[model samples]
Target: MSRPHSVVSQVPSGVLVVDKAPDMTSHDVVAIARRALGTKKIGHCGTLDPMATGLLMLVVERATKIQDLLMSEDKEYEGTLTLGVTTSTQDRQGEPLEEKEVRSFAPEEIDAAFGVFKGEFEQIPPMVSAIKKDGVPLYKLARKGQEVARDPRPVHVTKYEIRDIALPEVTFSVDCSKGFYVRTYAHDIGQHLGCGAHLSALRRVRSGKFTLERAVTIDMLKTAPREDLYKAMISLAEISLMRGA
Candidate 1:
């Protein structure tokens, strides 16, 4: 399927908040935006794992210039942490590294573990991440059964609340600084609890001032007319207002 050449050039330059569907990479969503919005200048501010779904910010044309600034904003996510199992990728997307029987723990014990990670602390970035070493992404090395030394970096868990707990599964919400990885957080929490754990599911609810409420789904863009799609884009001026909000 191809977009009209004339329409492509005429498409507005701005940000479009997308409620990204699970199993689609951030780049995949960008490709869809290109076709639906008739613009090849589309880019996303953040990378969401294929297993993740939620608000993904796409910048078009001139809006791409502020991509770095948008990426610097804090992020909020709600996800499930599954205990008693660990994965190479720290999420459900990877092979199982280890598994253990989950022992019953008091609610306060779980709360105390959460408190240990709150505020400012250092965390080792996971091997499954896009962080690069010698210009090659770490995930590439990970896929080849290679492991390398990585230094711990600082991350702040401003808000880490347990929304619910159902034995091996714990639903939680977190608001954290830029560059924080929720996958690593889940993995570390399990280590603290003496039971292996990994991120089972994730959904980004907020990125800076952009909320899931204002996000349009891929289906919406696919089914809507070009004119209606253009109306859904957030202007550069509005993004500037997000700084104040």
Candidate 2:
């Protein structure tokens, strides 16, 4: 069999940080970015559910070499939690599968529960995730009307705060290790509250050293030339080499 090509052989290496717009899959953004950069060596650090938006890391050219390392970096998200409902997708993107009475809790109660999520814990990933089981994405199997037992995986929530608490809606922020699923966390928290809930919205604000403030929108990318786009891309290696202050 012929050997697979490496990203190193495709083009010069660099990383593109994009502010992925809502409703567009990470792959869709990569496709447009590939065209914008005029090269095929592009790859993304991690997968973001289409309904979620914000910073998305893209590796271009030989820099795709660092994709694995970058994907391991911790992530930060500002997500909104909508109580009183649950969904198959675990987010607003999915159909409502169940509803429960909204329970009013004091800010201290909400904060305490959120505190329970902080630190290392085992978490079951959402069935809607892109994780592959036997070479098939879990979501694909879910769409086929199949359910499978999945083992809980360890993930760390370094910081989880209830920025705002409301009976029917809660806004919060979290910083978690790679492989952590905010969607699953939201659902689990709702369950604990005795009032089922799901993620209403999610926006990743940071990944490693890359922040959402620098993300380029699709429209902005559409009008920018490959040359300009190339200039904006940052390399993961550079980010990794930086010393923490």
* Candidate 2 regions with alpha-carbon error over 4 angstroms: 1-11, 243-245
For candidate 1, give the lDDT.
0.89
TM-score winner? 1
Q: Residues 1-245, candidate 1, lDDT per residue (tens digit)?
A: 34333344487888889999999899999898888887788899889999999999999989988899899889999999999999999999889989999999888888898889989998899998899999999999998989898889998888888999898999999999988989999999999999989999999999988998778997886666777778888988877786773
Instruction: Tell me each candidate's TM-score.
Output: 0.95, 0.91
Regions more than 4 Å wrong, model 1: 1-9
Candidate 1 weakest ten by summed lDDT? 1-10
- After TM-score superposition, the amount by which residue 20's alpha carbon in candidate 1 deviates from its true location, in angstroms, is 0.8
Clashing pairs in 2: 13-63
Cα lDDT tens digits, model 2, 36-131, are 676877899888888889999898877788788878989999999888899988888888999888857877877777887889899987888788
Question: What are the candidates' C-alpha RMSDs?
Answer: 2.0, 5.7
Which candidate number would show the highest lDDT if scored against the true structure? 1
